[model samples]
Target chain A: MSTRISLDGVDKTFTNRRTGERQQIFRDFSLTLAPDELVAVVGGSGTGKTTLMHLIAGLERPDRGTVSTGGTRPRLGMVFQQPRLLDWTSVETNVRLAATAAGIDTTEVAPILDAVGLTEYARSYPSVLSGGQRQRVAVARAFVVRPEVLLLDEPFSALDELTARRLRLLLQQLWLRTPRTGLLVTHNALEAAFLADRVVVLGGRPAEVVGEYRIDRPRPRSPEDPELFDVHRRIVAALT
Target chain B: MTVTHPVGAEEVVLGGGRSPAPPDRPPATGTAARLTRPLPALLLVGLLAAGWQLMAHTSDSALIPGLGDIARNLADITTSGALGENVRVTLTRVTLGFAAAFVVSVAAGIAMGRSEWLRRFLEPAVLIGLATPGLVKALLCVIWFGVSLVNPVLTVALAAAPALTINIAQGVRAVDPALGEMAHVYRLDALTRLRYLWLPAIVPDLFTGARLGIAMAWKVIVLVEIFGLADGVGYQLNLEFSQHNVAGVLAWTVAFALVMAAIEYGLLQTLERRAVRWRRVALR
Candidate 1:
C-alpha cells in the first residue's frame, strides 16, 4: 500500500570535528508527500537535500520534530548517488537481498531485473557491469522490495548525459507501473521537471521550500516536451 | 490525452548502447610467461644456498656450518622423530596463542573503531603493548608463570595482540559509511548486516591481522620457549647453542621457517583468495 510521508518542523545540525564548527542544515523545515505521489527536491550543493532524504529514511533523527510515514513504519527502498551495490554479490542476489530485508518474496527479483533490462546480467557481479548497468541493478533492487516509500538521491547524476536521460525514462516507467510515494533529490532542475509529479525547490541557509511546481502532464511524458522546458526554466529560476 | 508508449520503445532506447562487452575472462598468458613467474624466487634461494656453501668452505670457523653439516643434522633430528615432536609442540603453542589473540583483537578493534571514547581510552594500552620488546615479554611471562606451557602461550598472545588490534581497528574504521547507510535504509537485521555487510567488508583486514598475528605469535613463542620451556624447537635451539653445535641450531631454525612458510602460503593465502574472489574480478 502507498504511504504518505511528512517531515514537520525538522531541525538538524552537523558539527565539524577538526574545526569545531557547528553548521545548521535544517531549522523549522517542513515538507509532505501525498500517497503515491512522486516529488523531486531540487537544490544546490549543501542545501540539505540529502539531509532531508536521510531524515525521511530514518538514517538520521531530527533534533526536533518528527518524520512520519502516515503513522505506519513503511518499508523503504533507497537508490543512492552511487550504485552502492554489494560488489561481492551477484546482480540477482543484490535485489533478492533487499527483498528479503523488506520481508517480500524473493520471486519478485527476476521480474524487476527484467524490467531494468538486466536479466542476462543477473549472475554477473557489480564489478563487471558498466556504471549505467550497475545503477539499473540498483533501481531493480529498490523496486523489488515493493517499498511503500522510495527514496532516490541523485540516482542518475553520476552517469553520462545519454545514459542518465535513458535511466530517467526508465525510472518514470517503473514508477508508472507501480506508483508509490517517492522522493527524488537532485540538482538537475530539468530532471526534476521531467520525472516528478511535483518539483519543490529548496534554498537558503537552514533550507526551506523556495518554490513548488506541479507537472500536470500525463504518464510517459517526453523529455523533449516543450512544456517540460517551461517548467524546467521556472525551477532553474527558483534555484537562483 | 495520456501518451501511450510501448514497453518496446523503452527497450529500444536501453539497447542502443550495450556496455562494451565486459572483459570477463582474464587475458591468456603464454607458457613461457607462466613458467617465468617463479623464476626469480627460485634463483634467489639457489644463490643464497650456494653462497652459504662457499662461505662454509672458505671459513674454517666452527660457527660457520657447511650446508652438508646442516643437512646431516636435520636428517639426524628427523630420523630420530624429535623434529616432528618439537614441530608439533611449537605449532600447538602458536595456534592457541594466535587464536586467543585474534578473538581479543577483533573485539577490542571493533569497540575502538566504533566509539571515539573507547579508542581514546584504549590507545595508551595498545601503544604500550606495541612498544614492549618480545624478549621482555618472554622474560616477564617466565617470571610470572614459571617454566610451563602457560609461559610461552601467554607471551605469544600478549606480543601479537597489539599489532592485530591496530590492523583490525583501521579496517573497521575504513568500512564505507555509505554501505552502513544503505543497510540502515534497507532494514537489514543485525545478523544480516554482520554476515553480508560487516564481515565481507572487513575480510581484507582480518587476513592482514591474522598474518601479522601468526607471524608475531611464532616469534614470541620461540622467545618464551628459549627463555623457560623444557621442550620445543626453540629449546632445542638453546641446547645446540650451549653445545656450540652451530649446524644443529641452523638445521632446527630452517625446519621451523619452512613450516611457517608452508602455513602462510598453503593455508592463509589460499583462504584469502577464496574469500576475496570478487576483488580479483573487480581488479581485472
Candidate 2:
C-alpha cells in the first residue's frame, strides 16, 4: 500500500476586520494526490498554489473540508523558495533536525548531506552559503526525513538560471530515489513540464483546478526534446 | 573552500577585504585610508579637552569644572567608596527593572505579533505607555512605592516595557512567513525550531530592545533617584546643586554619563559582536 492524499470540498477565506474587506482565496477546492506520483502545480502568482499546499501540509486549516493521506495524517516535508535555512545551524545540523524530529538516528545525516553535495560545508552557517548552496540545503532538509509527501513551493525561484536547471535535474533524481508523493508548485512552465509526471493549473479568487496535462516523456529528459515542447505549450496556455 | 569563480571587480567575495563604491576609489588594501579615518575623532576629543582646560584656567572658575578636576573628583569619590556604593544601588535597580521589563515585554510582544486582534487592542496601550513622559511615570512610582530604589525601578520598567515590546513585536513581524510555514511542515521540535529558527530571526531585534531597555532603565532610574531619593550619584548631584556647587554637579553628571557609555560600549557591544558576527562581514 502506497501513500495517497485526498482533499475534499475545501473552503478558505480571510477577512480584514478594520477595512471590512473579505478575500476568499479558495471555495469548494478539492484535490487528490496519488502515491509516489510526481505532480506539478503551475499557475500565475497569487493563484494560491502555495496556499493550497499549505492546506495539504496542515500548516493551515481550510475553513471547511476534510483532508487525509492514506487514511491517516502523513508526514509532510517542504522546500520554500528561499533556503529558509536556520542561520545559526550548520548545513548538517539542519538535515539532522528533520530526521531527529521523526525519531530517526544521527547516522543517516552524513549520507543525506553527501547526496546533496554539501558534505564539505557541513558545519558552515547558512549566512555564508551561496544562494544555490542554500537552496540545496533546503532540498537536503526536505529529503532527509523521507516524508510520505514532499511539497516544493517554487523551490528554485531564487537561483540563477544555470543553478535552477541543475537543481531541477537533481529534484527529478530525488523523486525517483524515493517512493514518496511529490507536488511541485511553480510559475515557470518549462520547469513544470520537465519535472512533473502530471501538471495542474490553479487560479481564480475561488480557486478551482483550471487545467491538467500529463507528460509521457522518458527519464533524462532533454531541453531540446520535441515532446517536452508540446507539454510546455499546454502548460503556458493554462497560465493566462 | 578556496574555489572561486569570477566575482565583480568591486566585490571582495570571501577574504579579499575590499568593498564597492565609496567616492574616494582608494586601493582598499592601502594603509592611507585607514590612517585618515581615525584622525577626525581623535582631533575632536583633543580639541574638546584643550578648550575645557583653557576655559577653566582663564576664568579661575570653580563652577565650570576642568577636565583634571573632574578626573580628580572621580578618583576621590571612587576611593572613598561613595562612587561604588551609589553605582551599586543604581546598577542593582537597573538590572531588576530591566529583567522584569524584558520578561513582560517579550511575552506581550510575541502575543501581539502572533495575533492581529491582540495587536489591534494592545498596540494602542503600548503606544500610550511609550508616549507618557518617563519622568511622569517616575513621579507615579514615587507616589505608589514611595522614595526608594523599588519606586525608581518600577518607573523604569513601566517606561521601558512598552517600547521593548513594540520593538520585539516588529522583529517577530519582520520574520519571513514562509519560514514559519517551513518550520511547521518540517515538523521541527518546538525547542529545536526555537533555537535554530526563532532565535536567530529575533536576536537582532531582541538585542535592540535590550539596548533600549538598558538605556531607558538607567536614565529613568537616575532621574527618579534624583527627584525623590536622598542618596546615589543623582541625589549627590542634586545635593551639590542645592549647595550652589556647579563643579560638583558637573562632576557627578560626567560620572553618570561615563557609566552609561561604559555599559553600552563595553558589555553590550561585546555581546552583540559575538552573537552576530555574520553582520560584521557586511558592515566592515
List candidate 2 stretches off by more than 4 Å: A12-27, A43-48, A70-72, A87-90, A93-107, A188-190, A201-240, B1-43, B146-149, B188-199, B202-208, B227-231, B239-246, B282-284
Off by over 4 Å in 1: B1-24, B27-35, B143-151, B199-207, B273-277
A127 Cα displacement, candidate 2 (Å)? 3.9
Which ten residues in a row are the worst by lDDT in model 1 chain B? B1-10
Q: TM-score per candidate, in order?
A: 0.89, 0.80
Worst 10 residues of 1 chain A by lDDT: A112-121
Q: What is the lDDT of residue B203 in candidate 2?
A: 79
Q: Give the Å error, residue A79, model 1.
A: 0.7
lDDT of 1 by residue, B8-52 (tens): 224434334344544557766689997887788779889999999
- Model 2's number of clashes is 0
**Model no. 2, DockQ:** 0.28
RMSD of 1: 3.7
Q: Tell me, by TM-score, which candidate is best.
A: 1
